[model samples]
Target: MIRPKWTPVAWLADRMAVLVLGLIAGFLVGLSFAGDGRILPAATTVASTDGPAPSPVPPAPPVAAQGVDGPIPPQVTARMRRGGVLRVGVFGDSFGNGIWDALYRQLPTSDGYEVLKFAKEATGFTRYRTLDLEKRAYEQLARDPVDAVVISFGANDAQAVYDDGHLYPLMGDGWKRVIGQRVDRFVAAARSTGAVVYWVGLPVIRDPQLDADMQAMDGFYEAHMRRLGVPFVDSRPLTLGADGKYTAYLPDSKTGRPVLMRTGDGLHMIGIGYQRLTSGVAADLRRYAARVRQAAGRPAPTPTGEPR
Candidate 1:
């Protein structure tokens, strides 16, 4: 058999062709292993919205299971059994001032109840950058512990809020969620000290628009407090008449004659108004105290005929 002699250039070219083939085979094997023998299409690019998508609203934390069913803590019952002075902390905006004053004057002193007021006028949780109510309440709790806390706000919260340089209008869902989270934080802070929280809702305001806003805010407060197993007091019905209208005067308990319940500003309450407004709140506190005492197996004190 006769064979043609190969040139060095031809041999080199043949070797290069073999090397190229080997490289192609190796690449195909690697690709098959990477994709598990399945073919994938190229990824498609999607155009985003005009601006950054709004952040997903965070879900509120699950309600604490401890007190949801309304059982008083043993620590609270033990304190009640000690028969020492019971300290109540009143904290919030100016609306709280009248409530605290009325509670201090009317809460049964014979039962060893003392009220400590810590309200700031024209401040709320919405303007947290300016004044954080949760931080303030936490600081106060650290300074002096109280058996219970009374909170009333929203008077100054119905306004625009500047968050991260974005202005959110009042009474919007986003605004309400932010405010609700703040309330949750404050209530949690107060509860951390083993103190019961009583959130008082705002009453009807004179301005129809402001009144509607306040009513909406009250819904937020009530929902949060209920979920947290805290007591919520709605003062609107107390200030409103049977026709669901805001009244400056209602029949006084002492006298059947009409007595002024609201101040000229329509947002504030006069002394007599506060006196009447706080009566129901005082009753709730008394009932709570009684429950604590009863839970501790201690008999509640006999009535001294004190006018709540």
Candidate 2:
């Protein structure tokens, strides 16, 4: 890669690119939808001290006030498993990828669930020009045909944004408006397909500024989801310690020894960490599956076409 001179204007331009690319990868590896899958939201706020004693093995998703705002829409619940099996498509950035991994296992195929990954692509509302999530959503759902959607993004979104050829600070009104519109459109596209959509809020971060930005991102998404009647999943409590603070290492469920839950980059998590972080998402998916079975009055989920 050719290095650009760090002149004032060049440095500013480079930072702009960083925001669009999530500040991690050298190139954009957008999430694939309308063809393949993945989804996302953003987060931050980390505590330096060793967090308090670990909470229960898997904390229940937050009640409406904290973790969630409303229940899954009834219309979606009614038709989610129309063909017997419920097909769920997950989307977002790296965290979305982890959540998909956990959900795929939590809601196994034998139980009449097919969890397709939508996170393979590195895309989000911030990457509006790199990929069109809303359009891909329609195309992807039409091809893969899922009855439910799960999305977690914004981890790499605490940066700048673009609108009408103008650059906007991460938290600027223009950025929020653009990102919110993007969130609404992408989610609406998913809902239009009659799928129950859930937006997983940003998880705890180890950085102060980033975490604050992510908190704002969470509120933005939660408000949008609530407005559209899509269920919103809060991720903070799932990762926060008993004292309601961020901790990168939590005691292992079995050994009770502190285990690293976050990556060196302060963005990603290991399998064990993902297990802790995604517990709520896994729960929500299972609950929906059970509802489908009960509503169908079936002994077992016939879940469409033998669990893809």
Candidate 3:
């Protein structure tokens, strides 16, 4: 075999060839990276084995559990699962405002209950211009979601009612139907947010005419509550004296003497009166919360942070 003689030109050509090969290798390696120099992971798309994948199964809604108070609201149970407070939103007139404080005091914050005040003074089904109950229910719920709702309305609604270009004069001329529809709408909006609603009826007043009007309103609420299957808290019965009539004073449980329950104006009640007024509701709430915790597989919280 004849061997070629080694020369400067041959050596230079060999070096050039090595340089060209190296440059080509570097160019191929650079192409593997993105323009930003990030190494992209290899990916492959597999063709569908069936006619487009079946729509992803939506999560099942929370099931309602039957409890002593009533059917457990899905929202309430969900909140319990998240270890959140059981929120109670009160909406209506000044009565709602009063009862909110009473309820707040009854249901302690440390016990995992939150009472939100959405009540406004001088606002009712008759007074839509001041505050629209149905609209506000949706808006407020959207802003601060809640699990339970308590609505106290009626005292401020015994006056003139105007709806859809028509004026209703004091509990007459389609007043009951229209106002009942308004109540239904507000409740529907509230229930849409998965909150359980409670309707509070009118209490007995001092004035004869006002008391009669309140009784009539209470009748209306009772009829509607039956139809809607909502709880009707007949405050009149709760506020009645031993004589089975409206009374501003009741025998104090501890003192065994008459205590003034009504305010001087006779339009509202005192703090202790409110406490008594909201006792049933507070008990109902506690029971509902207990049910929620039970359904979520959690135990009741005791003082020592241990389950009861």
Ranking by TM-score: 1, 3, 2
Q: Give candidate 1 misplaced runs (Cα > 4 Å).
A: 1-54, 61-69, 81-83, 291-304
Window of ten residues with lowest summed lDDT in model 1: 33-42
TM-score per candidate, in order?
Answer: 0.74, 0.70, 0.73
Model 2 per-residue lDDT at 129: 84
Shift of residue 202 alpha carbon in model 1, Å = 1.1
The candidate that achieves the highest TM-score relative to the unseen native structure:
1
Cα-based lDDT at residue 153, candidate 1: 83
The candidate 3 region of ten consecutive residues with least summed lDDT is: 33-42
Error of 3 at 243 (Å): 3.1
Q: Between candidates 2 and 3, which one is better according to lDDT?
A: 3
Clash pairs, model 1 backbone:
none
Write model 3 residue lDDT over 1-308, tens digit each, in one string.
Answer: 66578474774574344334433432332232110011111022211242122233332233232224576767668877886568889886767767776787788777878899987765679878777889988998999888888888886776556665555555663576568778778877767767777777766787666688778887777766656657777777667787877788976655867887776545566666666667777777887878878887767765233211
Task: For candidate 1, give the lDDT of residue 122.
Answer: 57
C-alpha-based local distance difference test score of model 3? 0.67
Q: Model 1, 1-308: lDDT tens per residue?
A: 66568674775574344334433432332222100011000022211243333356776766754332366766676777776555678887767777677777676577767688887765777678878888888898888777777788877776645555454556655566567677888888887667767777787887776688788878777777777776677777777765779888877777667776665556777666665666756666676776676676666566566644
